[model samples]
Target: MSTNDDGIEYVYTRFITRNGKRIYHQKGGLYKFPKRSKKSKS
Candidate 1:
C-alpha cells in the first residue's frame, strides 16, 4: 500500500506504527511516507 505509493516497493521490508503515524521499515532503517493519499499523485 504505502510502499507502492512511496515508490519503495522493492526495498520495503514492512511498516510499523509509532506516534500514530505509519513508519516503514527497510534494511537501512525506517521512514514515513512523504504524504498519504488514497491515490498517489505521482
Candidate 2:
C-alpha cells in the first residue's frame, strides 16, 4: 500500500497460483471511491 503527494492512495495484492505463477491485483486511482468515516452522527 502507498500514497502519493496528491493524497491518492494505492493498494496492491499479490497472489501465488498453483502453478507457481505470481499474480498482482491493484486498486485505487485519481477517482477512487470515498472512504467511510468511523464517526457517525446519531
Candidate 3:
C-alpha cells in the first residue's frame, strides 16, 4: 500500500478462488472516482 502526492492511496485486496488461487485487486489509485456530497437546505 502506498499514497501518492495527490493524496490518493493505493491498496491491494486479496481474494481466493475455488481453485485456491490468490488474486490481488487494486483499490483506490490515481484514477479515483468522485464522491457525491449531499447538500443541506438552508
Candidate 4:
C-alpha cells in the first residue's frame, strides 16, 4: 500500500499475524481500474 514518486497507482492488501492469523487492511489514495479503451472512433 504505497506509491512511488511517479504516482503509478499500486497496492499492498493483506497481512498475516505471527501466530497464524489473517489481517485484512486497505490503504487510502488508491485508484480503481481505468475504463476500457474505445474500440470504435465512429
Candidate 5:
C-alpha cells in the first residue's frame, strides 16, 4: 500500500499465480487516516 502526495491513498494487495503472473487488486475507497499529532506516534 502506498499514499500519494495529492491526498490520494491507494490500498492494494499483490497476488501471484501458479503461472507466475502478477496480479494486483485496486480496491476503491477514499480513506484518510487521522494525522499524527506531535504528542502521538502513528
Candidate 6:
C-alpha cells in the first residue's frame, strides 16, 4: 500500500480467500482504494 497526492494505491498478491469464491493470487492487480468521507457533527 502507498499514499500518493491523489489517493491511496494498493497492490494485491497471490492468495486464496477463505470464502466468497475469491482468490487473491489468481485475481491480483493494482488498484486504488476508496477514501471515506469524514462526517462532522455541528
lDDT of each: 0.51, 0.42, 0.41, 0.43, 0.45, 0.52
Candidate 4, residue 24: Cα displacement in angstroms equals 0.5
TM-score of each: 0.29, 0.28, 0.30, 0.23, 0.28, 0.34
Instruction: Give the per-residue lDDT of model 6 (tens digit) for 1-42.
Output: 564545454645565345557555656666555434343334
Task: Show model 3 residue runs off by greater than 4 Å.
Answer: 14-42
Q: Top lDDT: which candidate number?
A: 6
- lDDT-better candidate, 2 vs 4: 4
Between candidates 1 and 4, name the one with more favorable TM-score: 1
Better of 3 and 5 by lDDT: 5
- For residues 1-42, write the lDDT of model 5, one tens digit per residue: 566554554543344333677554365344443334333324
* Candidate 1 deviant stretches above 4 angstroms: 1-13, 28-42
User: Where is model 4 poorest over a 10-residue stretch in terms of lDDT?
Assistant: 33-42
Flag regions of model 6 displaced more than 4 Å.
14-27, 36-42
lDDT of 2 by residue, 1-42 (tens): 554444444444444233577544465233332333343334
Instruction: Write down the RMSD of candidate 3 (Cα, Å).
Output: 9.4
Instruction: Please give the distance, in angstroms, between residue 12's alpha carbon in candidate 4 and its true position after superposition.
Output: 3.1
For model 5, the stretches where C-alpha displacement exceeds 4 angstroms are: 13-42
lDDT of 2: 0.42
CA RMSD of each candidate after superposition? 7.4, 9.4, 9.4, 10.0, 9.6, 5.9
Candidate 6: C-alpha lDDT:
0.52
Residue 20 alpha-carbon offset, candidate 1, angstroms? 0.5
Per-residue lDDT of model 1, residues 1-42, tens digit only: 336545443333476666999766565444444444355565
